[model samples]
Target: MNNFARSEKKRQHAAVDARQVLRALREMKQSERPSRVRMELPLPQAGVENDKIVYLGKHGQLADWSGGMRQRFRATRPLVDTLLEGRQANFAGLLEDAEDGVGVWACDGDITVLTHVADTTAGLLFKLLRGEYGSAPTREGAMVCVVNAFWTDGGEKVGNPWEFKLREEARDVLKAGSWEVVYCLRAVRTAAGVPGTIWRRYPEPWLVLDETGRVVLSKEGSEEPSSAEVAEALNRTANATE
Candidate 1:
């Protein structure tokens, strides 16, 4: 069959959670309210007009539409089928899990999916094996750090402490050549009653071979060793230049 035929056949076989489908349709019923926008932004990068941006509902359901145009379109089975396919639709966070467990599409508050990504391509189950992770959202506990800093700069940065530090470090390394980009799957969660895995496109979550030949992430504050530990590791790696 042709590509169009294949796509049609796939949609014909598409299936999604029944409970999610019902809830989505119900939200559509509620979204038939009034509008509240003075002027619309017409930037494609802003995604004011495009394939839907989906958010995970409480019960692994999907909030089909957003902004002022809600309920303007029906949340039909065909729509659900298209989303399940994940091709044309813009899924900023939502995805298809190859492994079996709790993710953005979980039924309850439990998360158990294969996180061994970096190998599996699109259209598969989620699983956690090794070398890297994808994501699983569960409310275990959160952390707030009390770091002892020794600053080299004259000002404190507005973002994460790691960011300011990385900027300082990259100034020296980036002058050399290209960096070996590492692809990683960073685990993420949310407290907006919606939590799950978030696949990051940047190598900040993955292992990178730096100019000094050290494996590291740009801003994984806790995942990497402390500064003192790294100094020791580097000292050990250096050859005697006699």
Candidate 2:
């Protein structure tokens, strides 16, 4: 068989094996299959920042590393309790509080993100405010983004690049942390015609990728997953089976 044909056959076999293994596990009742937690809270309304600590993306929950602009959405509870709940949640790194709140920089394989101590709308909190991430061209195939917000004495928004003025302690922590990160700041125009800078985070859909791109996970317009759901989708047509 051709290389493409061989790879396609292998992927199909892998998918079939995955389904069988999961079925066996469920049948044996050894452990429950992993699933997404659906505990998102009401999102924060816009125009609500009155010296507010921050913002969030996606149903008011903590930001996922991908989905591009969805990072600006916020959630009402801790993302770790849901998204990264159980073994997927990594807690091995420290991120200095933003002179405001407390949290840790978590690493999930090649992925690195932050999770806060508490999930309150007010008081000391590590607000997931909006910013830019992967706006620049780089050797890495995928782009990512996060924006750190600061305001001026007159309450005007003073732009702060993620690369500039990082706490020394935080910098040291990142140096030896999960992934090796070395990035330079780049300026881009904001929607309001002002210039700003952003820091990139790990790419997402969690752990599904290959030589082509993303492996399929779900059907179109489906609200919930089905029994056939697999992290990597089968990405080819079947043969005649002669």
Off by over 4 Å in 1: 1-109, 112-224, 240-242
lDDT of each: 0.24, 0.25
Expressed as tens digits, the lDDT of each residue in 84-163 for candidate 2 is 34324345333333432233323223222332222121111112221122122122221111112111112112223342
| Residue range with the least summed lDDT across 10 consecutive positions in model 2 | 33-42
Query: What TM-score should be assigned to candidate 2?
Result: 0.22
**What is the overall TM-score of model 1 with all chains considered together?**
0.16
Model 1 per-residue lDDT tens digits across residues 139-221: 33211110111122222222244665444433332222212211111111233222122211122342222223243223452
TM-score of each: 0.16, 0.22
Estimate the overall C-alpha local distance difference test score of candidate 2. 0.25
